[model samples]
Target chain A: MENHLKNLRAEKGWSQSDLAEQLDVSRQTVNSLERGKYDPSLPLAFKIARVFALPIEEIFVEEAEDKK
Target chain B: MSERIKSAGKRYRLEFGAAMTFYMVVLFGAKFLADGVEPGAWLTTLAIAPVVPIVFACIAFFRYYGSLDERERRLMSDAAALSLVIGIFTALTLGFLKSFGVFHFEWDMLWFGPFLIALWGIVRCALLLKR
Candidate 1:
């Protein structure tokens, strides 16, 4: 999966650690998500969308579709 | 580590370090003291004395594991399951190897811990790399 989490976090001037704090997750998780090295579970995806005040679709997209 | 995990992790490390130190000291110290002491079951009991701190460390591990959030717990569960599967396969292979007289490694039970740890690491890294 591909996500616009990096851009969203950047727009908020929140570092990965800052966003991780908001998500109640470790900084490693935030870093992994941003790096696309890890995928969040549905609940975590919902939490991230909640944090960004955006729809989940706006935050995360299928990686296959992203390539096109 | 997360804020929630940091304290537990520190305690776990402390306990693990103490356990390792105890094992090393008791192992070698037993060897040095062997000549002077009467040969008996006391030596066998002393050899296993490090298990006390090992038990303490296991408690610390449980605390640390309990402190993880749901997502982290999921990842850990995946890693542990993968490790167990791989560890069992490796042990079975080693057993067959021994039966065939292909290899005669003596550390039968000792291989499980290292194999589990190694496979857990490989699975974790593979999971990370895949996403």
Candidate 2:
């Protein structure tokens, strides 16, 4: 899944570690999320959405939508 | 990392260390006692004494595993699954070879634990590196 996590973090001036802290996850997880190498679980996706104050759909685009 | 995860890691280390320390002590003590005894129930009891600590170590490992995040847990599960699959195939192949007189060596059952663990570590490291 492609997500706007990197761009959103950048906009908030938060480093990966800072975002990881907010998400209560490891920095490596944050890095993997940004790199699109790993997808978040439902609860984690909700947490990320909450942290960014955005809906999950806004942050994470569906693969079909992304391909379009 | 989260404080919860950090504390989990610390607890795992402490528990695993304590268990392994006890295992070493019990193993050596059992070996020493067995040397002075004949083949009997007493000797058999001495031989399995180290298993108590090994059980504790396994408990510690499972508890630690429960505390990991989803991705980490997935990776660990994958590593363990792969290790078991590979280990079983290898063991079966070796057994067949031995039966066919193509292989000749005294393979101890005790060595399988460390072999599986080493394979798990190697597979886990490879998965991590691939990410």
Q: How many Å off is the CA of B82 in candidate 1? A: 2.6
What are the runs in model 1 whose C-alpha is more than 4 Å off?
A62-68, B22-48, B69-72, B122-131
- Listed for every candidate in order, the interface RMSD values in angstroms are 2.5, 1.2
Please give, for every candidate in the order listed, the TM-score of chain B alone compared with the true chain B: 0.75, 0.94
Candidate 2 per-residue lDDT over residues A24-62, each given as its tens digit: 777788999999999999999999999999999999989
* Shift in Å, residue A5, candidate 1: 1.3
Clashing pairs for predicted structure model 2, backbone only: none
Q: Largest DockQ belongs to which candidate?
A: 2
lDDT of 1 at B82: 83
- Model 1 over residues B56-78: C-alpha lDDT tens digits? 66676677778776656767789
Docking quality tier of candidate 2?
A: medium
Q: For residues B27-116, what per-residue lDDT tens digits would candidate 2 score against the true structure?
A: 999999898798999999998899999999999999999988888988899999999999999999999999999969998998999999
True contacts kept of 1: 0.29
| DockQ scores of all models, one per candidate | 0.33, 0.66
Q: Which whole-number lDDT from 0 to 100 does residue A55 have in model 2?
A: 96
